[model samples]
Target: MDPAAGLTDVRAASPTTGDDLVTLDGVAKTYTTATGTTQALSPTSLAIRRGEFLSVVGPSGCGKSTLLTMISGLVPPTAGEVRIDGELVDRPYRHCGIAFQTSVLLEWRSVLDNVLLQFEMRGIDPAPHRDKAVALLDSLGLEGSSRLYPRELSGGMKQRVSIARALIHDPSLLLMDEPFSAVDALTRDQLSMDLQQVCMDRGRDLTVLFITHHIEEAVFLGDRVLVMTPRPGRIAEVIDIDLPRPRRLEDAGREKQAAYAAHIRETFSRVGVYRRNQHEGGQA
Candidate 1:
C-alpha cells in the first residue's frame, strides 16, 4: 500500500463543511531594502476553506514564503488585509500553529518537552496537556524518543516532533513553510503519510497553508495548488488537483500524480520561471 493511504481514509471520512477560515483580500507585501522598496507580492486575493490543505508553489523567489509569513502574521502586508475566520489578523494569534523548514526545537529540551514548550510559554499548564503531547508524539511514530534531545533525532524525526508541537495546541489553522524539505526522499514520503493521518484523526478542520518548491510533494498533499510568477510575485494560476483522494504510491495513482506535476512544470516553463536560479546563480 502507498504510505499515504491513511490520509485518503481521513479525507473520505471528513465530509468537507464550514466556511472559509483564512481570506486574503487584495493582499500585497513590499520590503524596503537599501536598494529601494521592492514589491515581493502583488495585490492578490484568495481564501482557504476550513479543513482545506492548500499548497503554494512557484519558481524560486516567487514570494511563496512571503505569503506564508503574512498568513502567520510574522510580517505585515504593505497593503490588503489578512483575516482569520472574519477577524482581521493584525497581530499574532494564540489559536494558530506554525512549523517551518527547520524544526526549530530548543536544543536543550527533550522531544516531548519541546512539544510542550508552547504551553509553558503561554503559561498553560503542561500537566493537563501532557497526555495530548504524548499522544501526538506516538501518532507521529516518535513515542520511544520522547526523552531524546533535538540532536539525538534523525532529520525526519526532528520534523515529526515539530509537527507534533504545532498540533499540540490544537490550533484551528496550521502554517507550514517547507517543513519537509530537509528530509530525504523516503522519509519525506513517510512523514507526509503521517501528517495525513494526524489531520484526519483530529478532524483538524484545519486551514493549512503550506509552502513548497517540490511539485510532487505539493501535488500529493494539497487539494489545490497555487502557482506564482517571478519576483514581484503574483498568482499565475490556481490548479485543482483532480486526482481522487486516498492516493497511493504505486499504480493506484502514479499516472495522475505525474500528470499534475508535469502540468505544473510546464506552466512554470511557459512563464520562464523554472530555470531562473540556475542561470542567475542565486537562490530565489
Candidate 2:
C-alpha cells in the first residue's frame, strides 16, 4: 500500500471540474550545458483549481523553482505545455504576481514607492495607485511603515513589502518562492498566518502557488501539498490538508498537523531527500 494513498487523494482534478486556473499537460524541462543534457523536470500533468492555495514542497534542486518558472511563462518547457486560464503561456504572463525568494527591494525607494513600482514597470502612472499601495502594505501588516526605506526594515518586514508589491495590482494568481525562508522561526510563523489571512481577504478569486522546503509550512498553507522527487523532479505524492481555516502555529503538536508533517518527512526520506551517505556536520 502506498503511504500517500487515501490521504485526501490529490483530488483527481481537472477533466471533471473544468475550473482549473492553471494546467500542466505533459510539461517537462531540460537544460543543455557544456557538461551534457540535464532534465530539470520530467513529463508531468497537473491541474490547479482556481482560488486554491497549492503548496509545493521539496528539497533544493528538486525542480521546485523550475516548475514555478515554467508556470510563470518565464521559460518555455522543453516538452509539453503550460496553460493559464486555457491560454498558452509562451511569454511572461502579465496578469499574475510573482515573489522571488529575496525581497529584491530597492534601497532608494520608500516602502510605498517600492509597492508602486509594479505600475511604473507597466507604463502606468504610480500616482493613481498610491492609495492601493498603502492599503496593501497596511493589509500585510506593514502599516505606518510605507514611508520607511527598505534598509530600515527587518528581513521579515522587507518580505512583507515584497508581498505588498506583488499584490497591489489585484492579481488573479500569486506565485511565491520561499518568501519567508530567511526569517527566524517566530517571524516565519507570523508571516505564514498573515499570508493565510491576506489570501482569505482576497476571497475566492485569488489562487496562490507557494513553494517551500518546510513541511509544516506547506501543511499549514496549502489546500493540497504537492510533494516532488529529487532532481529531474516529478510529483512524488500529494497530501490534502483538510484542517479548518485560520491555522495556528501554536498548535504545532496538533494531531493532524503533526501527522501531515510526519508523513511528508517520511516521504522526503523515502525519496532520498536525505542521502544515506550524508550526515549533519554542524552542532546544534
Clashes of 1: 1
Cα RMSD of all models vs. native, in order, equals 7.2, 3.9
Pairs of colliding residues, candidate 1:
61-284
Q: For residues 207-256, what per-residue lDDT tens digits would candidate 1 score against the true structure?
A: 78888998888888888877778888887667677766566655324687
Q: Return the top candidate by TM-score.
A: 2
lDDT of residue 237 for candidate 2: 83
Give per-residue CA lDDT, model 2, range 1-284, as digits (tens). Answer: 24645322323533436788999888899999999999998887889889999999998888899999999999899998999999999999999998888999999999999999999999999998998888888888888999999989999999999998888888999999999999999999999999999998887789999999988999999898899889988787877788888888877668888888888888887777776643564322
Q: Give stretches of model 1 more than 4 Å off.
A: 1-18, 251-253, 276-284
Q: Rate the local accuracy (lDDT) of all candidates.
A: 0.80, 0.87
Root mean square deviation (Cα) for candidate 2: 3.9
Worst 10 residues of 1 by lDDT: 1-10
lDDT for position 61 in model 2: 88
